[model samples]
Target: MPPRPRTSRRTRRSARAYAILLPAVAATVALAGCASTVSLEHAEDAAAVECADVVVRLPDVVAEQAERQTDAQGTGAWGDPAAVLLRCGVPTPGPTEDRCVTVDGVDWVIDESDAPRYRFTTYGRTPAVEVVVDNEIVSGTTAITDLANAVSVIPADGACTTVTDPADVTP
Candidate 1:
């Protein structure tokens, strides 16, 4: 065979540079394809302390939704599509006519006005814990039940009552 053509210095340098950059570019693309990061607004200092327990005790999975990374101080998200989202240290809601359910000793006010999605907020807690789940994707009961343990960290000061008259019920 005839003598092989020698590669010029510039050509060799270009090949070396490309070889070094290929892996980095591939890694960046791979990371970008993963579940997007979620960031929530920070809560007040007082609520932040009250939320620490629940945040730390949150389960890795809820209603079959795997936990994902969150940048918020007191928030968590589960599933690639985010079937469940939790925010702690939220403002405590006052008495309302909304339906309430108690799970594992933790009272939750259920809001289903938005069909296919349900919002459950802890009742009577100083700094309430809020959990939003897509009913279409996961069972609302299961998701709330899974979070009961973490929410229990906040003590219950009161609960929902069915008394229609003050005189009919004894304090």
Candidate 2:
């Protein structure tokens, strides 16, 4: 009798399982690729109630940061956090800058990028707010990471969530 080839039961079982699952894995990947959501071309047709469109009231962090900035700049009074966030910082690249305001008790991040993901912490409430600048801010952002730790100016009330968009928007 000819010698039989050596084979393991576990190996046969593994091969059978892989053959059965290969098609399923491939189909799942293909479906995921096709299920992506695309943004609308015209801004007018888009939803008017975007996070950027609405500038909710800034909490303690943003308020205090604004006050500190005002005081640092030798200004008498600190204006509104939203306005100050948009107009306060010196003009720079990316146009997707960040504006934070802290009024001693409360503070919130004011990312000028897409969704404007900001965070606030106060005695009564501690919630995060992502403030996007309607059409101005695209789907991405333009700010450096670790801004809170990198820049001492960021108050303790605030914390960095995500990295800022690159300085340049590449095609």
Candidate 3:
């Protein structure tokens, strides 16, 4: 019986061909049109910015506000000054159609200038809670917009205005 010679190169070439061909076939199969569904995870959370106690600092320094007692008037209207007063723990002053309600000497009003609508002034300090998905009530200046993302009411535009004014629109 004669012994057959072992062809080393032939074996090597076939193995290499198989390695290349296998991946091509797999890739085509993966690309073939097919219906499939995938589920994705999402994350959500409320705004965590602090809204109280901290001192408010504004640039383009206004000498008037620095006087401790800033008389914010003509802010157009308080979304519902009455409601804002209630949120600030102000007692009922009297009957009124304006968005503002009276409490003692100073009238309480709602300021919705910044995003995530919020109260500009409180009993003594300004409320600093970041109103997420609401108006951007940054610092004290409120921007005019109709984004509908306002968390409170429409803010009075231009110049200084008090939310206590009945003309102001309250949420």
**lDDT agreement with native, every candidate:** 0.86, 0.31, 0.28
Model 1 scores a C-alpha lDDT of 0.86
Query: Candidate 3 at 168: error in angstroms?
Result: 77
Q: Which candidate wins on lDDT?
A: 1
Span of ten consecutive residues with least summed lDDT in model 2: 68-77
> What does candidate 3 score on TM?
0.17
Error of 1 at 4 (Å): 41
lDDT of 2 by residue, 28-103 (tens): 8887565333221222212223212222222324223232122121111122322222221221122223454443
Q: All predictions: root-mean-square deviation over Cα?
A: 7.7, 19.6, 21.5
Q: What's the distance in Å from true for residue 158, model 3?
A: 79
Residue lDDT tens for model 1, 77-105: 88878889998887887888889889989
